[model samples]
Target: MKDHPLEQVRGNPSRPLQTIRQLAIDPEMCMYALTMSTAESKNIKEAMADSAWIEAMQEELHQFDRLQ
Candidate 1:
């Protein structure tokens, strides 16, 4: 789950929605997807509040793990 060291991730608080979506759906952006914690970041809760976003995240997770 560790991100590729050569890859750089940037977050844009100015666009909370977009950032949250990316965080949840784009596992590559995170150095360790399974280790990424939401306890310190409420953005995920805010994003998952929308059912559509939740579903999207689920789909992406499967894709990332090749367990779909």
Candidate 2:
């Protein structure tokens, strides 16, 4: 059987144990979640074009209104 890419880094002293554990559990899902979590629009116009960003911004605004 072929080794997984992450498996090669299992013995690397510089790699954090927690990261290896998380990736070991599900590399593909972990990578997808990381990618989605880091994805951001570079400008307001781009952010406004995405419904997810719109919802997020609206929710943030609602929180500010509620706290004031």
Candidate 3:
């Protein structure tokens, strides 16, 4: 079994939720962007819209899907 990205975030809960938000938010987001845009909103709206990721998050992360 592979480790989930959110699991890594759970390691240091003090780091803030925005950090964890980045992984599922924008897989392609750069390192510098994460730091620079830390204050800015990290929108997972696009990712949440993706059916595959949403299902994976539900099955793997146990987040329920109420979008339908």
Candidate 4:
């Protein structure tokens, strides 16, 4: 997996967390629930660390292609 362009080169761990917070504000993207599952879980941080962001972006791009 790779890192999403928006997630690329996150200066620090907080960066992704911030982005996640911001995205959550978008009503359209609200369905893409990204939050801590466990009591001490940190899904945003894990997303940044695991490079799931990139994979998600890639998936989104494919979805766009299919529509065309």
Report every candidate's CA lDDT: 0.53, 0.68, 0.50, 0.53
- Per-residue lDDT of candidate 1, residues 1-68 (tens digit): 13423222334334434455676677665544445433233587777665556777898998989963
Better of 3 and 4 by lDDT: 4
Query: With candidate 4 superimposed using the best TM-score fit, by how many Å does residue 1's alpha carbon deviate from the native?
Result: 17
> How does each model score on TM-score?
0.32, 0.53, 0.26, 0.30
lDDT of 4 by residue, 1-68 (tens): 13445444333444344455676788544444332322232567666565456577789999999999
Question: What's the best-to-worst order under lDDT?
Answer: 2, 1, 4, 3
lDDT of 2 by residue, 1-68 (tens): 13345423324435444554676598885776577567898999888777778999899999999999
Number of colliding residue pairs in model 2: 0
Residue range with the least summed lDDT across 10 consecutive positions in model 2: 1-10
lDDT, model 4: 0.53
Candidate 3 residue 46 Cα shift, in angstroms, is 0.9
Best first by TM-score, ranked: 2, 1, 4, 3
Clashes of 1: 1
Off by over 4 Å in 3: 1-43, 62-68
Tell me the TM-score of model 1.
Answer: 0.32
Choose 2 or 4, whichever is better by lDDT: 2
Ten contiguous residues with the weakest lDDT in model 3: 1-10
Query: What is the lDDT, from 0 to 100, of the residue 66 in candidate 3?
Result: 43
